[model samples]
Structure formats: C-alpha cells, structure tokens
Target chain A: MECSVARTLDVIGERWSLLIVRDAFYGVRRFDDFRADLGIARNVLADRLGSLVARGVLERRQYEARPPRYEYVLTPKGRELLPVLLTMMRWGDRWEADDDAAPVTLTHTTCEHETTPVVTCAHCAQELSWGELRTDPIRVRIPAR
Target chain B: MECSVARTLDVIGERWSLLIVRDAFYGVRRFDDFRADLGIARNVLADRLGSLVARGVLERRQYEARPPRYEYVLTPKGRELLPVLLTMMRWGDRWEADDDAAPVTLTHTTCEHETTPVVTCAHCAQELSWGELRTDPIRVRIPAR
Candidate 1:
C-alpha cells in the first residue's frame, strides 16, 4: 500500500473521482454540468467533488456573489494527472470502443495532429510496449533485527 | 456515461481492484499470494478476483486436480493495461513519494536502463508535457432528430 500507484489511488480512487477530473479536462466546470454529463446521482456528485477539492485535485472558484455560486477547476496537482487519464482513455479506446471510432480523439495542439498517446522510457525515449519493460524486486529499506 | 474511459473504469475502478491487478503484474498468481501481498480481506479479494475473471481482465487456471486449486493470471486484455498502471506509478513517484525515493523502481528491461516512463504522441513521437495537448469538441454521430 506504500506504492505510489496505491497512494495516488488513495487520493482519487473513488468510483466517480477520476471521471470528475476527466470532466474538468473537458472544461466542464459547474456542478450541474458535471452531474448532467456524468449522469451521476446528485449526492454522489457532491461527495466526489468535495473529496476531489479536499484532496487538492480540484479547487472551487466563486463566480457569483449574490448566491455565492462556484465552479471547480483542476489545481496544479490535478492537471498533472493528465497522463493518468490519458492512458486510461487510450486503453478504453483500444479495448472498450467500437472498432471504427473512439469516443474521444486526442489532439496534440502544438503538433496539430490527432493521435493516440503512448508510454516511453524517459531515458531512452523508446516507446515501451508489453514485454519490453520489467520490474526488479523492490528492496525494502527496513532495518533487519 | 458511454465513454471508453468510463467503460474501462467500469471494469477496474472499484477500490482495491487495480491493486489486485497490480499484484498480478508482479507475478502474484496464487490466491494466498495475492491476499498476503495486498492485505485485502478474503471476501473482498474473492469478489474482486471473481469479477476480474468474469470481466476478462484475468482468467483462472486450475493448477491442481485433486482439490481443484486455481491461480489467476492476466489475460491479453488485462496485460494491455500496462500504460494505465505505468502512468499512475509515475504520477505517484512525482507527487506522492519523497524526493529521495520511490517505493517501486521501473526498469526498461530491453534497454537495461533505470528510468521513469513518460507519455508521448504516437504520431509525432514528441514528448507531451502538460499544456501541450488539447481536445476538440467531440462530434457526436447521432442522427439529428
């Protein structure tokens, strides 16, 4: 459970949490929009949003003073979760979507080319596929008695 | 709700689900191994494993005939989830772990280098950092009513 993946999941592992973050990436900022877009129950949406804000994945910014209405936006920490969402999207596109179409297509705005994103080694910059990568046994630093 | 990411999450979004899959990736195949490694309660573990098997993410193989002992292994579909887990691990390393250490070290076995995996555009092979990507409004193909 000390693993980083587990830790990251600790903050955003709830059922509706990552979807809310994904909606934020799509520029859906308001509570009503998130609720409508996700088709999530109201209380569930509220809870997920509150937990996301509490976890620093999203922050509330007031846009109305009369009723003190607010919208949520991704924090710096949340925005950095792009890869996590993207990879999931890519996996979904590959495994879950119809063969002819993906529900969402990712566009690299700078290159202006639409494409699937991939994982590559930071050092060699080679695209890593299954069977190309391996893990060494993790060495626990606990003191031996 | 019909989005691929949502569909993918439908398969693996439950609490401890991905961790169970993570344990599978680490070669923890036997039930006791998964239970000991995850510290998950037996009932919860059994439920998750059954769901994983039913959903095609994992499959059970009978290893002993006398008492019908079984072990789980990732299927091709499950194995394709590599990027999703890698990105999560990378995010944890950067955000959750201390500057000096990460709990797990990923190695590019083919390249034989110790490194972090990053996301890149499949088309341009350019490293995609934050803010370099953008999304177009998805064009729904539904026939106009």
Candidate 2:
C-alpha cells in the first residue's frame, strides 16, 4: 500500500505481532518467555518472531551454545516503535481500561514524573490533538500497476 | 489482557480495522469509498464497520434518504485514535517507506509547519524516548477463574 500506515501494518499490524513486540519491551527475550507471557500458540509465536526478525525489527542472537538457544532482542528500528506502542497503551488506558487507574504507568526518567504520552509537533513543540493538525498532501504517487 | 495496549488491540488491533480508521482520517466516509480504497473483502469490511460502530469509534449517520444510505464518521473517541494512527504512520515512514519523502505530511495547524509527531511527558513536557521512560507496574489484578 502507498500509505505509511498500511506499510507499517504490513510489518507489525496483527494483534500477535504487536503483543510480541510489547512482550519484547517488557524484556521477555527467550521464546518460551514470550509464549508463556502471551499464551500464544507455539507455531504462531514462532512465525511472528521469525517475521519480526526478517523485517529487521528483532534481532536473533545465539545466547547459548550447548543447547543452541536463541534470544530475540529489539533492533534499533524495533526500539523506535516504542512511541507507537506507548501511544496505544495510553489510548487503551484512557478508553478501554476497567478501572480509573492505569494498570501500569510510565515514569519519565528524565523528569521523574508519572507521565502520559502526548503527541507533540516536532517544530513548535506544541502538544497536538486531532483538532490541532491537518493533513498536507505533499505528493501522492500512484503506484504503477 | 491486563495491559492497556492489549486491551486496545482487542478493539482495533486487526489490520483492516486500523486501515479503515486510517481511511476515516483521510476523510473516507462511504462504504463504497472504503471498499474502493482498501480493496478489502465486502463482508470483512461490513463486519469491521459494524464492530467499529458498536465500539463507539465510528458512528453511522444517515447521509442519504433515497435508499437509506449512511456514512461512517469518527466520533470523539475515534478522533482520539488519531495520535495512535499518527505515531504508527511516523514509525512506518521512518522504517518502511522506500522513499525519503512521506506520502503525506501532517501540518501543525497552530504552527503552520510540516510536523513530526513526538511523544512527550504530559507533566514536564519533555520529549520522551524508550530509554528515558521506565514502566512501573502499578498492580496486577488476577481475573477469577
């Protein structure tokens, strides 16, 4: 797809993929840990992990040599997905959570405050909401069939 | 399921659901329009639209009366998902896009500059990155078996 959202979804759009990435952020590196934490089927987890690695989101490193064990770690590209996941968590906490309190809270290490992630304009640094932004179609290049 | 990100994924984690929402941000309203844009299966699109409407993200409003035609519009809750979508787009552009230029750019209407959305701590307004944030587990309530 030409749209960036579609392209991103092509890589990590599925619930399992994002959930696995979430688990990775939680520092669940071993395959068994991901399967245990997510309760995902072994085949599905394997497939997602393989795809993520192939897509350069996760790096597979041999952690043990005797039994030939591997661990999945987020690459730089995968680490950059933190904002996407953080924003989703914030949205879910606001709209989907059962309780008033967030199940988990993010602490900004630099400022030492319980923080809510807000999307801000990189140029003016203004916190942006839906109303404060407009889409500027820079160029729409129709893909050649 | 306890994680808000997982909860949010329970709602819109599917690729098609997010694609439809992305199209909504692009001002797509009609069923035909969504179908035309995404080339998604009609039944799947119908199912997704129905679920989104049921979830209060998209509202179906009567736009034509000749044969009871309706258009899907983003509700306040749906509009709140813009940041989620924007962050994903930003991530995709950074990693997935083959070209340097983004297919579309968001302009901060307040600042009138092409903007990149950055996640920031709401309290101190400092730009947040993965290393600068730490996840604190508040509480985990076990579900009754």
Best by TM-score: 2
Poorest 10 consecutive residues by lDDT, candidate 1 chain A: A136-145
Report the lDDT tens digits of candidate 2 across residue range B1-145: 7889998998899979998888887778889888988899999999999999999999999988999999999998898898898899998888998775646778889989989999889999888887787778722222223
Going through the candidates in order, their DockQ values are 0.52, 0.57
- lDDT for position B125 in model 2: 84
Which TM-score value belongs to model 2?
0.92
Q: Please, what is the TM-score per model?
A: 0.88, 0.92
- Candidate 2 lDDT over A1-145, as tens digits, reads 7888889999999979988888787777888888878899999999999999999999999988998999999999999999889899988988898875647888899989989999899999888877777777632222223
lDDT of 1 by residue, B1-145 (tens): 6677787888888788899888787777888887777788999999999999998999999999999999999999999888888989888877788666646777788889987888899888888865777655662222233
> What lDDT tens digits, residue by residue, belong to model 1 across residues A1-145?
5788888889888788998888888778888888877789999898889988997889999999999999999999999898888888888877778766547677887888987888899888898775767666653222233
List pairs with backbone clashes in candidate 1.
none
Distance from true position, residue B61, model 1, in Å?
0.7
- The TM-score obtained by model 1 is 0.88
